[model samples]
Target: FTTEDGAVNAGGSLVLFDTATAQQLYLKPGVFQNATVSAEAGVSDRKLLDEITPLLPKDATAQTGKALADRQAKDIESGLTSLNTMLLAFAGIALFVGVFLIANTFTMLIAQRTRELALMRAIGATRRQVKRSVLLEAGVVGTLASVIGFLLGLGLATGLRSAMGLMGGKIPAGPLIVSPTAVGSAFAVGILITVLAAWLPARRAAKIAPVAAMSSVHATASVKSLVVRNSIGGVITLLGSAGIVGGAASGGTSGRQLIAAGAFFALIGVIILIPLLSRPVIALVRPALKKVFGVSGKLASQNAVRNPRRTGATASALAIGLTLVTGISVLGVTLGQAIDKMTTDNIKADYMVSMASGDSLDESALRALSKADGVTALSPQQAAWFEVDGEYHSASAVTPGDVEQVFSLTVESGSLASLKDGQVAVGSKTAKENGWKTGDTLPVKFDDEKKGELKVGAVYKENEFLSPFVIPKELADEHSASTRPEIREIWIKADGGASKANEQAVVDALGDNPAMSVMDRQDIRDMFGGFINTALNIMYGLLAMALLIAVLGVVNTLAMSVFERQQEIGMLRAIGLDRGRVKRMVRLEAVVISVFGAVIGVGLGVFLGWAIGRTLSADIPGYALVIPWDRLGVFLLLAALVGVLASLWPARSAAKLNMLTAIKTE
Candidate 1:
């Protein structure tokens, strides 16, 4: 008998039982099945874990906490660490970009306040006092901004908590954590950045001579500075180039890390070289601008190169962000293309049935699927590892009929029909490496003391799916020690073959077999391809944050430029240059700098991407260099848009400047 109300019927269930005689099917004293004892109410969790530790195997790893609680904490901490690392890296990048802005702002502000600083020095203020004053102001501003930013970060974390759940993280909800370390670190970083960025400007301000206070002049980068900068940059570039070459020659994880390090070093060198190259690049582009946009473009071009150091700094900020964005895009596109090409070129089977890893396909299930409607041919294969001359190699055993029906084998000199008991087919590449030809006997040994000399039946071309050596199933079964030969994959060919139709028929025939999945060529590609794209998407999202910071750098530079050139802008306005022309000039200057950065970024990104792709292709077989030209075009267009948006406020501020006041001011 059951309760009148069921779970879905909007009421709770109730069970009736006799007070004295009703019995449960089973009873347990603890929540877990394997626990020897439960902790009393007064006992601490750590004490219970310590007691249980001695009862567990000596080699077993354990931690102190409730099982669920420990697991939940581990999962959440792991996820948070991964997420926090990525965010902090991006934050570091933003802060790095902000250095240029902060330095430039302070430089411009000090230049404008030269007279005021000189007047202070002339009166009673010491050089150290002036420097201290500036640092104190920066500290005040930094502290306030850091506190506000920290509070905002709390709200951001709340949103990210939800995002973590969507990304398959199992995060347990509890009281929001606000660590002292995090808060202190945030404040320390802000203060450090502000102080460091303001240092040079403050030093320059302190050196202002009281007599020269009336004069306004700015010092250019010294010849010695240029020489030292170029020499260091060149050495770094050479070292990075060497690393790339080394990475290409090497293989595996070490090679990948080398490549990343090389790319980073190369980018740093390029950033250092930007100031040296900016003027020459501007000279090269000036002729084209003069011929195309005429006077306005010429004027805009002149403004960009007028302050080469500042222009280069602004461009470098954008370049750093774009380099990473383009690099990741290049790598992702190449990987996806390689997978597509591998699928299309190598796989010839119409349909494939595969079991879960470590699971064997049932013989009865295979027989039933073989007799399924429209299945004209099926090739069941078993993968095996064999030792040849003390080196291990992977090979698969398949029937001869399976090759003709499901594979496009390129037989170099022998027939597939020659593959018989105690014989194998080797790939052409493998045969050449091993110095073996058709009809030659090669001693091979399998696990369980199964040893035999197998003749090379045929040599086929190397393919992604085709192994180094493929032996006949009959030969494998005869010498194998196991009672049952486990089939891992079955290649299928339909009578009236269309991949979609064949796939549907196979899926239908498989019925409720949860262990196997029916897939076609495209499906196989999607399985691996999806992972690459998802990784690329996550990276792109992170880089977008960096790019956003770079955009802010552009805005900051242009705003400072407007402040420095108020008198010049007023003069132009007084002399009949309209508001629209002034705006156009500022906007054009931003676009030129942005384009310069984009061009350099794309060139570097493509070169690095190609180098890495070529290195990986040595192991991956058929990977080819693939450049996504269309995407680069879109990236360039977006950079231009970023320039326009970055200039909007700065241009408007310049255009709306009071002509009389600006021209009259010192």
Candidate 2:
């Protein structure tokens, strides 16, 4: 008994003793503490609860095991839900970018095999047979890739679980289960996406005429097709622009939805019009490229615009990732600014006293805090969930007179001091919603069925610091829940305002409880701001996957472009273009395309951010549109860096091409 030890690591200190010894020391006759119960094997939770419900005393409460577990794991469940949602969204974006890579790869592959396809047609192969051949190849590649990807994903999951455990996360000890549904979904999505991406390219391959086998010309999009595509894109873009403008002008939840829809359409339109946009966008940057890189830069610009479709597809992936990141950044900045302004303008208290664990303070802690020296006034607030006319709402109880000293309440009608026993003060928004005014009576009930009618004595302007319904502390105590109500917060007005001495005095008063904390105005602001920053960091981590996929898309496009232009690069090399200049040309082309996409993405993101902020401003007080220009600039710079890194291998390969072999390639 002198020393204590645990048989297992249960994430906390534990002590074990014989039943009789424990009873003698901690349990007395006719008294009992909480007990844990487990159902017999094969027994359902419902049956267990049903059997145990009648065994408890009339005044005692009983909770099912499932309910208890759910209550304990609520926060963890919420966090996981949010994490899963973000991961799924970004994963979808990655897959969408992959579509462009797969399609582009198939396009180039078919172009390289144009003669082969035409020869098959000349040998009496039907168009359907040729198309099927291409599709069958895609299916085989998809199957192999899917298997490898699934195995890698499984390994990653196991590694992550071990890492989390090493970092002190409480993970259950068991083998990881690979569900059939997940396996099925992985293969289904992979195969479907690959086949779909290759369908268009396969169609193009099938259309190659028999005569094409004797010609060196490759298939290209006709001018008529470009005109049709551009027209469709322009119309969609116009409609999307109109939606965005209307959404910004009309501020509400509906407006937010409209903005979301507008963004979707705008993204689709922009993607379609990128081929047309490539000309002007590259043209604008061509002069700067020439000024800096000289002849190499000029050649790079020409190379980029040579096949606008390829350039457009390569850039689209990066653009999509940047667009999402920029929009989220804008929203996060706006929200952080709004919170800062709201806290500074509304909170009048000199210091806030609360628990470090974020739990409610007991009555003893509140009494001790009230005895702190240099305290001019103290307002202790208690919160509880109460039913009003069958709907559950949160209610706060506080001393009416003490509230005015610690909070800035703009009285729309009546006064806070008039809120006596059997009376309550309601926020303006709540009052308007329920059609309740000063002197109106509201019927409220507690969980124990304790009911009473409270008269509304005051109507105050709504602020973030105050709850909707404020009742007297005496009235709350009379409702018969517990002997003493738990205190949620205590606002203090120090004798000489907020200072180190005042803060130390408050800390000293609560010395018996080491979990209590006293925070000044700045601390409060920082605490809330920290929450927003944490959220933004998580979002950035999730979006990194999409950005990685975009980088891969750039690499794939540049490599394929090098393969298609092998002879062209050889011709340039023969004309006295050195290896360094060849490399510079490729790098400059990537830079132009990357910068082009980043510009469009950033501009679109800013507009979307502004529209969404306008919608939120109607509901949130002090909300304003805040554009993080510095962050946007950094994103553009990173995009340019991505271009340089992506082009390294392709440029090297282009530079290393043999002059004689490349010239005689055709």
Candidate 3:
């Protein structure tokens, strides 16, 4: 019923195509968008819906034909809503931070051209003309940048899809769809952000008095303004601190979210306070600079503090990136340590035999493993998840002998051996939560519609791997209707040490079971630990992209600073400062600002990391805050390198500036 090329073939002999093409090809009725039948006329569509509702899935719904069409449209949109939201959120964050860079650039540019603008205004240019001129210039730049960025993003999207495929993602091959709405939105957002950023600078330039055309004097920030700014920043910092403390005591997902929100608020407060702090920090470094590089260091320090707002704004961008990197590093290291400790302490068995992902073990394999040479004891474990009082919980069925021989069960009240048919052992935390005590009879319901009541025979200490509620193997088999239950793991106690524990014999006995593996305690830990490290490394890689953007901001700030100081640099060269000294001064300024930002970021990150770790430690067993000093040292070194590299172009440009031209610049 469809043209051959127009069809979407999904295997077999069948294909799906447009209805118009189908009708033309077949010349027969096939399927409409929807169809309905009735026994008689005058039956409302509502009646048809009711009659057909019973045949649908429980959660599925039916509607009138018009409503059905609307719902179909909504369903199509609903599929992409989550993906769109994620993209927008990420883009929003980058743009929000990039605003600081954009505003800073415009501020510097406008301030340097103040005299030129005043002259233009004196000659004949109206304030509106001057503002429009600036805005128009910004618009042209924004449009070109947006178009180029959008094209680059398309390539990035294709690269990301291919990268995901290489990483074993299950993405289907399809033609890349570039909708007009998406392109329009990207350009609109970019231009809007650029124009808004330039608005304030444009207004300031237009407001310059014509009399100021002959003046080159710069104004210093007022004390009252500094006081008001610092006061507001302090209040924000205090509020954020309070939120973080509150989050530490709070529990669950909401608490974690509060901690994240608090960190963000605190960072913003610190950035706002940077101008107030910059002068004092630079002053403090003056003595060291004077001692080391002599006059050049003194000059660099003076330039760095000339406009505290400019220096602070430039540093704050780098600070934000470093804070996140440091925070993630601290958290990852702490988590890895906690897991290692937990696994080492809880697992007492000499060896463990288990299947890898997407694999299972049969009864014969279990029996063969149990009968292997040098195996003194074996515990077979199987999972039978069940519901109790409308709450789902993992319910493990373990052989009775394993509790005493293979595991170190710290029974709080009753004996572990008391667990038998139709009896269960609950962890202390679970018992406290559910109000269950030893000797309490609990109603249990399995997925297979089997129901039973089990007596709580014991209450043991918390275990992350083992189920909170444990049942006997025989009871699980009798209640569950399945022909065979897959064995999750078999804990083995060797008569000899783990190395000489006849692992080869156990493997050989399993014969054709290629999926199962025999691993000792350390091997088991490494298998899981490897997954954790891999995930953490991937997160670090993604976070580095933010740092890359921060580096760009640094470069932009330094380049503008070079342009603003051209006359001063020319005079210094005329007096006697060599090109090498000129370059060194620029590079040194970059390093000083970079180090200052990194120090502040690292300090804040450590505090946040420690607090977060403490909060998480309450819920997670064996979790403790651990700081890797070596990693932090490497981080500091990397920051220094980034600073030097970021300043390379600016330093070279400042050194190579035509002294004659710069000295004559207005």
Candidate 4:
């Protein structure tokens, strides 16, 4: 009979029948892959687990319903956690960048309203009243924005679910639930962040003097304030740098956490210090601008440094995005290089054969491959877990005679020839960790209680290509609990190396099993490289959102700058500066700011990458720091391009201004 599809059987057909009838029709007596046991209503799953625990075999495990469900969902949960973390990180970056944009907007708005604020003060408005008014306006804007954002987020989630389903991912069939907590959090965060961003501008507005109602000068931060900010920033930066160095030297999980904390503080410190940094950085680029665009370029450079704080805030957003992207690129490149070095240094086989689905190869498939044309020596590897002194350790079983043909093993203290029955080869790292040495005896037991003792025949140097413990195939076959040993991979040395003909012969021998894959050394390297590239691409995609916000910040800053510099631009136009030159000036200023941010970002990213790589070196064999110079150069070039793109509208607006009207304005 047809059965309703549940979460476990979503996207697939299901049928139900009486267990006795099914056994009579399709099953042999006492034969089944698995059986499900359930308790009556009101019985707890813990009681079921307790009852089954005593009846289970030594190797079997009894889990409660919740435990079993969690175990089964562990991988999916881990994947979702990773995905959510990445999304949240990028989202936070975007929000952080938006903070700068929001702050700048409020600052400019208050600056323009200086006279109005001064008038309010002259009419007996208290500083608190003026501050509260600005904050109230911010709160209203925040509420509206929050409502819009929440609706958009709901739409986006729905779209993502649909897309996942279309891509063949299983999705539970139900309406998406919107929790009260989520709604509350959305409004709370939006309003709080907006009000906080506006606070500084509101304070500045309140500081406007009553006498300033008769003046035309715009409100700006005092020298004392700038000095205080720079001092605080410098102190924070120094602390962050120390933490990074300590984390790198320490090297572990705790060290990584320290590094993360250091990175956050370092980023914030750098952002705070950028206003002080902008002047010198722009000055350094001034000469190049002069050489390229002459007077217009010089004008752009001067204008960029005119408001260092504004320039710094706009550029800081871009810097944050690029820093993350560049750091990830460095790590990805380093990992790819490490894998390439490991494979090249250790693997000697002409070709490697394994299941594409990562399942075990059957004896028949192994036998067929051994008899394939152009095959000279073949080493089949089997993986099994053995309990050694009550600790389960994974061991790889290999043909002792044929291993040397497939792998370039460096014996540190013993000989490979001694790795026979009742003998094992231990990797140096594993040996060091467990205090194992050559000739040390290990009492081991298979899951089926097949007991054996193995002597450490050899202690070899660490090799990333091989398992920590190596055992003879004969010994594994004798002690393994399974009816047959599970062959994980077969390393093949063809008669004429890795040629297409030899690869085809091997494939032909296996009858072209869809589950299996035959790969050369380069193919294996490429497989790992593909994984790294995919991860990098995903990161780049996420970081693009932050970069987009940064671009908008640049656009917003340039637009405001153009508005502020109207009279100056009018004077330049009266002196014969054309629309094209004005546009070029605006674009060049954007480029200078963009390049300045990119330089800091790239430098910080490389340093952070190096620090992270140092932490990984102890665990990863042959790990080395690799800098992808070409990629960094490309990122810098893209930053310049982003500037050019960001300036399009602002430049156009500046060019179209009425010169006479602008010059006549107060």
Q: Write the per-residue lDDT of candidate 1 for residues 1-666, one digit (tens) a residue.
A: 644332313223344544322222112222221334567999987888888788776656556447856797688689789778877887887787777767767777777777788789889999999999888877887888788988898998898888877876644446688999998998999888988888888887887776686466454556897899988988887888778767866856787789879887987888888877788887788888778876667888999888777787788877877777787789889989888777777666778788755466756666777778888877777766677888888777777766667776778978788875556888888889889899898787875477867788888887667578787777766655554566777888788765666667788788856668877767878976889899888888877776787788788878988888889999999999889988988888888888888878887888788777767886675677888999889888888899899999999999999999999855
lDDT of 3 by residue, 1-666 (tens): 564331223222345667767654433355334445453587788787788889776766667777867887699679889877755755665676677777788888888777778889989999999999988888887899899989999999999988876776645457999999989988998898888878877887787777864475443356886789899989888888777777777856777778888887888889888877888877898889879988878888888778888888877877876776677778888988888877777777777788855344567776887778887777777877778988888877887867557666678988777775557889999999889999998887875677777788889997666888777877776766455675788888777757743766667767735677788888978876777688667656656666776677778888998987889899999999999999989887887777777777787788788768767887778888888798888877888788899999999999999898989865
Query: What's the lDDT for all of these models?
Result: 0.77, 0.83, 0.78, 0.86
Question: Candidate 2, which ten residues in sequence have the lowest lDDT sum?
Answer: 3-12
Which parts of model 3 are misplaced by more than 4 Å?
1-88, 123-129, 167-170, 217-224, 386-393, 404-406, 420-422, 443-452, 495-497, 500-502, 517-519
Candidate 2 stretches with Cα past 4 Å from truth are: 1-83, 166-168, 241-255, 384-393, 420-423, 439-455
* Among all candidates shown, the one with the greatest lDDT: 4
What lDDT would candidate 4 get against the real structure?
A: 0.86
Clashes of each: 0, 0, 0, 0
TM-score of each candidate structure, all chains considered together: 0.79, 0.87, 0.83, 0.91
Error of 3 at 253 (Å): 3.0
State residue 120's C-alpha deviation in candidate 3, in Å.
3.3
State the lDDT of candidate 2 residue by residue for 475-543, as single tens digits. Answer: 776773544466778988898889989988888888845778788989989888889898889788878
Angstrom error at residue 533, model 2: 1.8
Per-residue C-alpha lDDT of model 4 across residues 1-666, encoded as one tens digit per residue: 555546454665444667765554445445454657899899888888788889877867767767767876796678799777878778888888889988988988887778888888998999999999999999998999999999999999999888888888777688899999989988998888899999998998888787864486576678999999999999888888888889999999888888888888888899999999999888988998899898899999999989888999998988999999899999999988887788888888988889887877877877897789998888887887788889888888888878878888999998888875558899988899999999899888875688878899999986666788888887777776666568888999899799889989989998988778999989988886789898999899888888998999899999999988899999999999999999999999999899888988998898899888889988777898999999999999999999999999999999999999889866
Q: Candidate 4, which segments miss by more than 4 Å at Cα?
A: 1-34, 37-79, 165-173
TM-score of 2: 0.87
- Distance (Å) between predicted and true CA of 336, model 3? 2.2
Global local distance difference test of model 3: 0.78
